[model samples]
Target chain A: MVVDHFEARLVKLARKGDQGAFAELVDLYKDKIFHLAYRMLSNRHEAEDIVQETFLRVYKSFHRYDDKQKFSTWIYRIATNLCIDRLRKRKPSYYLDAEMNDQEGMDGYTLIPGDERTPESEYLLSETQEMIHQAIEGLPAKYKSVIILRYLQDLSLQEIGDVLDMPVTTVKTRVHRGREFLRKKLENKVF
Target chain B: MDCKQASSLMHDYLDEDLTHGQAVELKSHLKDCSACNERFKELEQTEMVLFAAIKPRSITASDELVDRIMSQIPNQRKQQAWIGWIRKHPALTAAAMFLFVMLFSAISLWESDDQLVVKTADLDQVIINGNTVTVPSGSTIAGNLTVENGKAEIYGDVQGNLTVIDGSYYQASTAHIAGEIKSIDQALDWIWYRITDMFTEVAYK
Candidate 1:
C-alpha cells in the first residue's frame, strides 16, 4: 500500500540503517502488521512480539530485500512465516477447556464493525468475528495463512499465493477447503 | 450449472473471480433451483460476514517495544563491523576470543551468587519456588501462597489459603492464619492439586 509520499524514500534510507527512516516505516505499517499477527496468532502479546521481531528482521535483512515488491508484502511474508514456525512448535493438542471455548464461541459470537448496524447485530458480528478467528486458529498452517491473508488482510488470491509461494490454483483450493471447514464448524449459525 | 458444477464454483462465485460466462451460468441455475439458491445465499452470507468481521483492527504495541527493538538492532552497535573485521585477522581474533570467554565466565560467576528473593509485600501473590519461602515479618499475603518443592516460613498473617506442594509448612511463633494451611506430599494430593491448578488457570487466566 502507498501509505505516504515518503514511503519509497523511507525504504531507501531504512535500507541504509537510518533509524529515523526505519521508525517512520514502522509507524506507517505497525498497526497493519499487528492486525495480521494478532489474527494469525490469536494472542495480543505474541502478536506484539512478532511485530517487533518482524521489523528487526527487516532491518537486519535489508541488504537482501528487493525493491521490486511492495514492502508490506515482504514484511507480511516474514511475519506469516514466523507465525507458522511458532504454530508448528506448539503441541497439536491444547487444553481441552480452550477447545471447548472455541466450539462454544463458534455458535455464540457475531459482531459487525460499523456503527450503522444495530447494537445487538454489532454484538453478534463481534462474536462471529471471535468465532471465525478461533476457527481460523485451529486450521493447519497452510490453510490458516491463506485464509487470513485473503479474508482478513484483504489480499487478492494471487497476492496471497505470491506471499505463500503457492500456485493460484492451490490458493483457491485451500480457500475452498478452509471455508468448508469453517462452514461445518459454524453449522446452524447465521453467518 | 448443475448442482455439482454450482457447488464447485460456489467459492469462486462468492469471491467474484468467476468468468462472466461462468457467473451467468451459476446465476441462471440459482434462479431456477430453490435449493441451490438457498445454498448460494448461505455461502454469500458467509462471504459478507467474513468481509465485515476481519477488518484491519489496531493493536497498540507496548510503549517500549520500538525503543527495545531499536536498541537491539545490529546497526546500533557501531563496533560490530570492527569486531567482524577483527575476527578476520587471526591475531586479533585470538585476543577477542580470550576477552569474550573471560568476561562471560566472570558474569556467570557473579550471577550464580545472586538470590531471587521477592518479598510478599511487593507481590500480589507469592509463589515460593526454590528451597525455601520466607514471608517476612509485617507482610500479609493478599492472595493464595503456594510453596512448591520448598519450605514456607510464615511470620505474618495470610489472607488466602497456604498450599505447600511437596514441601513443609512452618508457622512462626508470631504467625497468625486467617486461612487454612495445607501441606500436600502424597501422590493423590499431587494429582488433585494438578487438576485443580489446571481448572483454576483455565477459569481465571
Candidate 2:
C-alpha cells in the first residue's frame, strides 16, 4: 500500500492540531526512533526517553517542517541530532547503561532472553554482542552514527547522509572507516 | 588495478556502488592479491558481525511516553494553531483585513456629514455659503481657480485650471473652460495641493 499517502494525510492533520493524527504518527515512528536511539546510546531507558523527546520536539516544530522533504527524513534527522547531542554531552567517557548494569551485576545478556540455546553458546553470543557494542561505543560519535544507521537501522548511504546532514561520499567514507575500526578491535576475538 | 587503487575502492565494491568495469577490475586484483583480499574479507566479516550482533527486539513505546508527550502538546498546539491558521489562510486573512479597513473608512467618511462646493470665481462675482463657493453665470475668471471644501459650477469662462477640494465640478452648456478641471477627495491629496499652493503664493510674493 501507499503509506506515504496516509502519512502525508496524518502530517497535514497533525499540523492543524489533531492529537489523534499525531498519536498515529507517534505509533508509526516510535519503534524506529527508539531503535535508533538504543543503537546510538545503547540504553533502553534513555532511548525510550529520547524517542518521546524527539516526538515532542517534532510536534512543537511541526509548522517548521518543510513539505518538500519526506517526513521520515525529517524525523530521522531530528532523532539522529538528538542522539548526537546526547553523545557529545557524554564525551571523554560515554558509558552505556548496559555497562552500568554490568557493574551492578545484571549483565545485558541475562536480562534479554532469547531463543533456546546451550548455556555456553548463549554466553558466547552475549559476550560477542557486548564486545561489538563496546567496539561501536569506542568510535567517535560521527563514525559511530554512520555505522549504527547503516547496519543497525539498515538505511541506505544516501538516507544516512540525509539524516546526518552529510554528503553521500562522506557517509560512505565514515562507514568504511567505522567498519575498519571495528574490525581492528575484534581482530583477536572469535565471532 | 593496482593493490593501492583496489584498496581504496574496496568499500565501494562491498557496497556494490562501483561501476561494472571498476568492480570487474577490483575483482581481478583481489584474485591476484591475497593481502588485499584478506583485508576485504575481514572488513566484510566485521560488517556481518556488526549487523548480527544488534539483537532485534521490539522496544515498545511506553504508555507514559505517549501520555507525557500528548500532555505537553496540548498547550503547544494551542499556541501553534493560531500561527498555523495565519499561515494556512494568509490571503484570506489579508483580504478580510483590507475589506474591514475599506468598510471602516467608508463609514467614517459618511458620518462626517460635510458637503462642499468648489469653484473658480472672480473675487467680485463669487457667492460663498459657509463651505460652498459658486461662480455667477456672467463672471469670467482670468487666473487659476482653487477652492477647498467646496464645489465648482462653471457657467462662466475659466482662463486656467479649476481645482476643487472635497467637492464636485459642474459645467453648464454655455460654460467655456480654457484649462483642466480637477477634484481632490482624499485628505492627503488635498493637503499636498494646499502645501504646493502655499509655496506658489510665497514664491509669487
Candidate 3:
C-alpha cells in the first residue's frame, strides 16, 4: 500500500514531462483520492473536483518536492489542506438531491422508490452517515484535518503529523478528541 | 505498565512504534485488566469502521492546468535560462531587488546612529530633566509610562504605575494620581536625603 522507490522514479519522470507516467500515477491514486475527497467533502461532485484540483497542484509543485520526505505525505498534505478549506466554508446542513416523485418517497433527505427495493437498513445507515458527516462538519478545522488523514486517508499518526506540521502527540490527541466528539453525536443514531 | 498506563499507551502500542519491552509490558497489563482490554476492543473496532469508511473518491484533473503547463514548457526548451526567469516572476524579482536594497541600507545605517535619530518627546509631552522624568502636570499618556533609573512625578491621572527605581519622588499637592507609586529605593541614600531636603527645609521653615 506504500509508494516505493519504483513509484518515486515514475513520479520523477512524470514531473519531467512524461505524460504517460503522469496519467498512470493519476490512475493509481484516483479512486483512493476520490473517496478521500468524497468522505471529507460529503459531496461526490465536489470531492471529484478536489481530486482533480489536487492532482493539478501536485503537478505544479512536483518540481519543488523533496524526495527524501515521502511523496505520499506531500500529496496527502495538499489534499487534506484543500479538504479542510472546503469543510471550513461548508455549512452544517447540506442539500442533497432527493427525488420527490409519487413512486419514490423521501427518506429524510434521500429519495426511496417503491420498486427500488433499497434495504431499510441502507436508508437508516445513510441518514446516520449524513448525521456523522454533519457532526464532523461541526469540528474545528484542526481536528477535522487530523481525523480525515487518520480515518479517511489511512495515513499513520506520524504521517498525519507530517502533513499537519504537528507532533505525533498532537495528531493523536486531535484524532482521539475528534472521534470522542463523533461518538457523542452518533450515539443514538448509529450505535 | 499498569492498566492506566497500558490503556493510555494502547494507541501508540497499536502503531507498533513501542519498544519490545514496553509493548510486552502493556500486553501483560491488558491480560490482567479485563476492563481495559474490553475498552481496547471497542476502540479498535471504532478505528476499523472509521478506516473502512475512508474511501478515496476519484477526482478529474483540470484540462486547463495541463494545457497551460504544457504550453509554457515548449518555450522553456527554446531557452534554458528562460525557465529561471519564468520561475522568478516579475513581482518576486522586484521584491527581491527591494529587499536587497533595504538590507544594504539597513546594514549601512545600522553602523551609523545619526540616521536613526529617535524622537522621544513632543513639546506637549513630558520632558526628562536630570533626576526627574517629569510628566507635564495636566497631560495624558496614550501608552505606557516608564521611569528608568530615576523617579516620575504624577501631577495628572496616570493610567499605569509610577516607578522610582533606586530613587523616589513625592507628588505635588495639586496632583490627582490614579495609579500606584512604587519605590524600589532600598537605602535612604544621599540622593533621597537631598530630594527630601527641599521639602523638609520648606516644612521646617
Which candidate achieves the best lDDT against the true structure? 2
Off by over 4 Å in 3: A1-3, A91-139, A183-191, B1-7, B17-38, B55-205
lDDT of 3 at B140: 61
Model 1 chain B scores worst on lDDT over the 10 consecutive residues at B113-122
Stretches of candidate 1 exceeding 4 Å from the true structure: A1-5, A95-97, A102-125, B56-59, B74-205
State the lDDT at B187 in candidate 3: 35
Query: lDDT score, residue A146, model 1?
Result: 87
Instruction: TM-score each candidate.
Output: 0.61, 0.62, 0.51
Task: Judge candidate 3 at residue B83 and give its lDDT.
Answer: 57
Report the lDDT tens digits of candidate 2 across residue range B1-205: 7777886788887677889899888888889989998888887888778878765543344666777777888887777778878889999999989998976875575447465534344566667767656667778888778776666677877788888767777888878778877788886675577678799879999
Mind giving the per-residue lDDT tens digits that candidate 1 earns over B81-170? 576578679887888789889768755654453344333343643435567787777877786676666688888878878887666778
DockQ of 2: 0.41
Task: Give fnat for candidate 1.
Answer: 0.40
Query: Docking quality tier of candidate 1?
Result: incorrect
* Evaluation by DockQ, superior candidate among 1 and 3: 1
Q: Candidate 1: what lDDT?
A: 0.72
Question: Candidate 2: which stretches are off by over 4 Å?
Answer: A91-125, B58-61, B82-205
For model 3, what is the alpha-carbon lDDT of residue B47? 61
Task: Quantify all predictions' global Cα lDDT against the true fold.
Answer: 0.72, 0.76, 0.62
